[model samples]
Target: MNCVKTIVCIAAVMGASANTALAQHTFSMSSEVERVENPLLTNISPGGVTVLRFAPTYAFESRGERYRSRLSLSAVIERTSDTTLLANRDFPSAGYTWGYAWPSSDLELRANLSESATRNTQFADFGRVTVDAREREFLTGARWNKEMTERTRLTLNATNRRVDYDTPLLEDYRELLLSSRVTWDHSETEAYYFEPSHSRLTPLNGGAVSTQTRWLVGTTRALSQEWSLDAFGGQSRVKGAQTETGTLGGVRLNYTGSRLTSGLEWSRDVAPIGAVSRYVRNELLGVRVGYRLTEGTSVAGRYSQSRSTDVATGRGSLFALSLDNQLAARWTSSVGVEERRSSGFGGLSGRGWAVRAGLVYSYASGL
Candidate 1:
């Protein structure tokens, strides 16, 4: 949702001080190599190819007793990757963000300003390319996370973002979303979160406008320093009789150490459309393990499986595996493979595999 955009903007400006800091500022570069295979493989076919890529990240942040600030910058470049069963093309991206926040007497104010530009071609079909789609979003919000009683605390938040997308310029959606999230913080270990948000979609094309409403409720249990459990459910109702229902429930168990962490999780989701549509259910199982092999190197891997069901699409299953390595302080590399089998019209026995690698260079400092 638009919420992710809001969070990333803040993280960019506050730099990395909110969680971790790397001695004023840090920079690094990395690259990846890949190989893929598919039934449609050909000499120049979408069968699979190998590719090399690069990325760079730079950031600097500061923290004070009552104030914080950050600036984050990033860029990525890649060309005709040979390790993927996809098309051959070049794609690059960059972003800039600045943010600040201050705490006032009974309330807090946070502001973010960000601008981003991206251009890339779709791999499968060359005709349907995003000729031009860029976005400039600004967010301002206030929040309260104080205690009203010794046993309970009521939290509230509100935010606004102005978004602009540019391309052929035929269609535009400058939507306005306003929401207030309230939570009953029973204690540090037990809390209940409830949020109700609404959005109004105004078409720049001057067509009929639409509105949507969403309601969510969630609970969290902090079992220990390295383990937690969460459960949440939400519903989205459109302007018409169209409605979407979602349910999320998950349990996480992890063992943590100074240099190693491992976790296992399971989740289930169900979505049913109101009208002439389909009902879908997803069952997921995941496992993750990470180890800091040395001061400058670390390794991690994950495995996941999912089974989905629907009306028209019938049923499907997906299995994926991935591994990541940290090198030379500034270099991070990863490779992953995923296979999916599904049934539908024109559906054949097929699978897709992706192998990716990239290099990045970063430089940042405080003035």
Candidate 2:
């Protein structure tokens, strides 16, 4: 079956079994205006462009003795001063999740389905350059977890994902992945885990299928009430039109206090680039800090740097700062500034800055 059919079937099943004692519904709406310089990070226009965006979301949830289910729908409406730069004006997204637990068997099951579309690539795992195309994705997955002993557990997961672009600049692909993990609680302060997975990626426009196998081991340690650390290392092997093997790992440290929070993270891994129909190894480092200035105000800042192992792929850095304030009982506002610089990537390198301000209104009640 196709992704749409699968998602519909899952939604039907969840709706049919929605006879629960505890149920709730929620709705929220938000609007924002942003002025960005070189919005596309290209030389097309060097002047600032203004953008207005509106977003609204709705969600329904139900819970029984041993099972819970949730469904959500959302949409984005946008207008840009330079319509030629960004074409798509509206985007719709949906998601559904259902989970159940068996106390007698010490087992739990969870399933999720989601669909989304976006024109932003800043957070995309593969793409660093801003493109003029919209990327749409469909994903469905299920997870199973079993408690084998007092201090040991096991988990299994399966997923299917598909990606498509509005333009031919990027290739469309479908991927299937199966993975398993085992965990052991060594002590009250530390836990360790091992995971292995395999995935197959096939291009829709006709090409050889790429397969990847990965093994990872990691541990989480709670150093103190306010400080914690997590570290993981892994190896990946890929086979298809081209073959390669590489090592990947990541580490993170975090701290939390009554009014202060900070974190540092670094990672290196192989990422799939559908545009090129291949994978590249990249490294990333990030630092973030946040402070509560007053009872209803807070400030946060983050810095991130990323570079590919291949010189031709290029590198980039971004610095961002934001301030958030509670304006009323159900209203909040935020203002942010961001600066970015990039080099390489076949003439896709440039520097830019942007400023944004937004307001959000939220309300919730039991149904």
Candidate 3:
């Protein structure tokens, strides 16, 4: 998506909101700074780095009891100390969402459109990149839901996404997805769901075109007022130059209370490899817990384990931990450490560790 296009789309939505009655607007600004050792988390070369970031956002929301709509615009500016490894980046994102439901009825309709541009590097984007690349994406989607019976509900959704990259070496693709879900309410605290989806991935550079069809069965249950569990398991069939099928599923357990919130998850899936002709199978496990020390202060930490392999790249794992604190109403900071170790093609060899500290200040107000 082009920056101009995002701006124009946001402008159009804002203009349309003017005719709607009882609309509210909000504005927020946030600034952050981080100091890091081995910033990119790469196994090859590590260096000390500092990063600065600023983000400003504007949002307009409707205040209807049933019918609702929202338009939001966000922009980001980032600067890094070591341009040779990690360059400066900027991102501009805009989105419009609208939903409607009838009073005392069990039917709903929703739609969304978004455009965004980003320039950055992420270690989890499959591999480490020595240079920064720009990417743009456009998304449009719609969903409908209806009550099938007193104990059941059905929903259908469709989405289209386009991704473009400034680096011609990276593949650009358009994705179309269609899905349906059905949920059965066994009780106030127990529910089960069945979901099926179909997706088509078409490459713009004459690469292999892939299609996937998948189905999942899942359940959600409240163990208690403050504890819950969600679990799902499924399988997917992929068709392309090479046909492949694999198991795909995940499970999550969560806790919610007055002063504590935590979650644990495990997943396995087959995902399309970026700019590559094949797909990779990934297995991941993660858990996070946080406790509020006071109204304005909290402490949290997280750990995750992942292993992935494909025809082109080997398996790798990443471990990370952090301590976070909310100093005041609008001020927050965190100290973190992470290590990456791998022993495969395109994977990290020796273990590399990085320590980081960051502070963020944000202010928000109604417009």
Candidate No. with top lDDT: 2
Q: Between 2 and 3, whose TM-score is larger?
A: 2
TM-score to true structure, per model: 0.62, 0.91, 0.85
Could you tell which candidate, 1 or 3, scores higher by TM-score?
A: 3
Clash pairs, model 2 backbone = none
The ten-residue window of minimal lDDT in model 3 covers: 114-123
lDDT of 2 at 277: 52
**RMSD of each predicted structure:** 7.6, 2.7, 3.5
Among the numbered candidates, top TM-score falls to 2
Q: Give the C-alpha lDDT of model 2.
A: 0.77
CA error at residue 80 for candidate 3, angstroms: 1.7
What TM-score does candidate 1 get on C-alpha atoms?
0.62
- The parts of candidate 3 lying over 4 Å away from their true place are 1-24, 40-42, 103-122, 125-132, 277-279, 312-328, 333-335, 340-343, 350-367
TM-score: model 3 vs. ground truth: 0.85
